[model samples]
Target: MMTQLLKVVPEPQAILRAWMPFKSVVGVTSVRTADDYVQARATVDALVDEIRADEDHPLADVLDYLGEQVKRYEDVHFTIPEAQPREVLRFLMEQHDLKQEDLADCAPQSRISDILNGKRAISKDIAKKLARRFNVHADLFL
Candidate 1:
């Protein structure tokens, strides 16, 4: 049955011709078509299921290949923004339910107001205090 299916399906090279752009982007010239991607995904999923069902299965190579392919696809598709100082500060304030007055222990109420409103920058001392209070990296404020 597998041999028959292989015979019916176009070879990997033929598939690559149809999916050259995606193949080039993923650095995988061997993958030829959308069907090839689907087949690879299904193979990876099956390997994962088999590994889950039998932990002792010798699937190291399969797992490594799946991880590489998945990572390549994800890198080309998924993007996440890095946190900025203002965003980090806002997140901390929201998480702690803190108001400008609540920051009096760290800085003057006016300073906190200015910092929150982006009117004033956070100094090293303030960054340290905020890092301690929010349990975050001080560099986030810098």
Candidate 2:
């Protein structure tokens, strides 16, 4: 005669007990300080380097979660003044030490100068190229 074995399922809290340690190990906690935000940002940058634009990457959710945490901290502590798209572009250009000619990959120097001077607006195609070059969201240029 053979004895049959029974499988036991752990309770929800017990499952969480096993998960919390792993979560803390990966630094997945609420950002409450500048140090916490820095750590979260580092984790997000690392995740981006690993995941790139692959939505199917295993760490995509982790990146999203950490990104949200970083955004939350910034929303509370760092409020960016709203500005027009051209003004934003100018500010980014200054910050990056870029000139109209430096944006040749995004647009013609004349077009870049026009946009910076408020004589013309940024088109969607140029906005996409600028976003890629600046490593920022295209909506910033829009």
Candidate 3:
């Protein structure tokens, strides 16, 4: 005599019923196009605002899921080159329409000029000041 194996499968109707509301509320099952990716990105942003640094928040896993989806789309569609700290600072300054003298709160004009010219590195104190001024993390400067 031979033993037979049993297989179990979920009911498709039940799965669909459960998934319909979830997909509607969550905005995506997966990112398939630019529009879908945008919706997923917006949802992820909302989740981040709600979740902040709380790993135990109810929607933390949802944020992680959508973040992964956005990352997948970006990895396929975008190529971000690695930028040096000086390059990052330059870009931020340009975006803010800032001259070296405008960063006087963070550093002296000469220091800022040296940093832009790659002659001086940004110290932690300067990084913190820039982060506060630009509303960005200090790690970008470091």
Report the C-alpha lDDT of model 1 over 1-142, residue by residue, as the tens digit.
3554444778899888867875454343332455545555555545554554343568746555655664465346533237667667877677447777866656888988888788988999888766544434588898
Error of 3 at 11 (Å): 4.2
Q: What stretches of model 3 exceed 4 Å from their correct place?
A: 1-12, 85-142
Residues 114-133, candidate 2, lDDT per residue (tens digit)?
99888999999899877655
lDDT of residue 79 for candidate 3: 44
Model 3: per-residue Cα lDDT over 1-142, one tens digit each? 9998988877999899988999989878698799998798678757755665566999878777777787688678854356877888898788557789877778899999999999999999899777655545688788
Q: Which predicted model would earn the best TM-score?
A: 2
Backbone clashes (count) for model 3: 0
* Segments in model 2 whose C-alpha atoms lie over 4 Å from true places: 1-10, 84-138
Give candidate 2's error at residue 16 in angstroms.
2.2
Clashing pairs in 1: 15-32, 16-32
How far does residue 55 in candidate 3 sit from its true spot (Å)? 0.7
Scored against the true structure, residue 50 in model 2 reaches a CA lDDT of 73
| Clashes found in each candidate (C-alpha, N, C closer than 3 A) | 2, 0, 0
TM per candidate: 0.42, 0.57, 0.54
Clashing pairs in 3: none
